[model samples]
Target: MAVEVAATRRRFTRAEYYRMAEAGILGEDDRVELIRGEIVEMSPIGRRHRAFVGNLNQLLVVRLAGRAIVWVQNPVALTDDTEPQPDLAVLRRRPVPYKEREAWAEDVLLLIEVADSSLAYDRSTKLRLYAEAGIPEYWVVDCVAETVEVHRDPGPEGYRDVSRVAGTATLALQAFPDVELTTAEIFA
Candidate 1:
């Protein structure tokens, strides 16, 4: 005779995740993000990905200095159980400095992910997550294809508007229409 047993997994809240970090279970060097109440290890950044992030940061900062804040590799709390650090996030200029409080999903104007190794995850998981969180705009910069996948009009199902920008096409943020970057400059 044999007996049946059930197994269950534990889920963590954002507070618990921070507690883990405070207790030394998670370290500053650990590249992990909270996803749907689970701690997920992030993909290692490649040279191409790193270059694109730096390039985008430089371009956005120069263009939207006073208009918006360009956040680099910083975590934006999407929910009580999810906080993923994006490659870059354009945030609305607020009176309260971000140093006083971390950014929330509503603070984001545009979120960007540089995809090389994590292309699939960025497209599927991150895209859906950002959409569900009501992120106004999300961009996936494909290093391999040298293109940008733009998503807008977020909803519970996902982004209602999706488009690919390539060649000499200009990429502009919905929040700041005047700010633009051509694909040529992006790929370079």
Candidate 2:
């Protein structure tokens, strides 16, 4: 069988994404986000993905507890994209604190996505969106490849520095000093 597909792309903004969310176009359980104005559905999490994010969350809690916010699976509002949730986020400390509350883009110091099946989208789409918004740092926990790609140096365009860390290799944080993680631990 043969089929045809359009080459054009969808355009949207953070406001529009919020509207959709408010109108119930996206449900609470829907694992989707507006990336570069296009709605992208995230793959259903399996054991591996959940475990990785969970482990990272624990590590962040221990190291960045009072210093930094160990935020997990929360939406970060960005331009051209509304609240795209990342797996784990090490957020900058707030004045009053919102630990039990949800996190927004302004609260984020580092945004991380644990990618097993959606690696390309995380790399191409979310990375660009994060950089364009001047996100300080971004990390991709590559489960399939067993590596962590650290992204930093956010400018108007995108990140300027990117490095991949393998097993037993520690990846450091820019804003959160003394906090480091190894690939093995993240995947463990």
Candidate 3:
């Protein structure tokens, strides 16, 4: 008689994930993020995606100014097992510099992901993760469709409010409603 045993998987903590980078197990060039204790390889950023991120970064920095800090392509430590490097993260300005400590979920005012090819993953997996972490606001910019999907009022079940905007529609951050950007400017 033959018996079957289920395969087991090992999950790494945030410290272990960093140790992997320090020990050369994972290089800086490797586009990956720790999601629920698992290292997930991120999709390669295309030209359009890169452009959108850049535009958004510039626009946010100029508009938000001293109100918030615009962090681009940096990791926000949501939990011990979940650290995601969002494309653009609008963080609450504080006396303690980010160099001294990483941005936590609570410090995030807005998180934006420019999804050129990973729209599905961004809308589902990342959306749920941010919502569960109480990120407050999240935006998934779909490059192919030239639209922005906004998610707000997060709960354990996910975002309670979700909406999509395209064309010349004005898009504003939930935290900073005064700061606005148009879909045309985003896709341009």
Which residue ranges in model 2 land beyond 4 Å of their true spot? 1-12, 96-104
- Candidate 1, residues 14-55, lDDT tens digits: the string is 999999999999998899999889899999999889988989
C-alpha RMSD of each candidate structure in angstroms = 2.1, 4.1, 1.7
lDDT of 2 by residue, 31-104 (tens): 88767677788788878898999999998899786788776887777754556878987777767557565566
List, residue by residue over 57-140, the lDDT tens digit for candidate 3: 989999998899999999999999999999999999888999999999999999999998799999899999999999999999
Q: Which residue pairs of candidate 2 clash?
A: none
Write the candidate numbers in order of decreasing lDDT.
3, 1, 2
Weakest ten-residue segment in model 2 by summed lDDT: 96-105
Where in model 1 is the C-alpha error above 4 Å? 1-8
Model 3 vs truth, CA RMSD:
1.7
Q: Which pairs clash inside model 3?
A: none
lDDT of each: 0.93, 0.81, 0.93
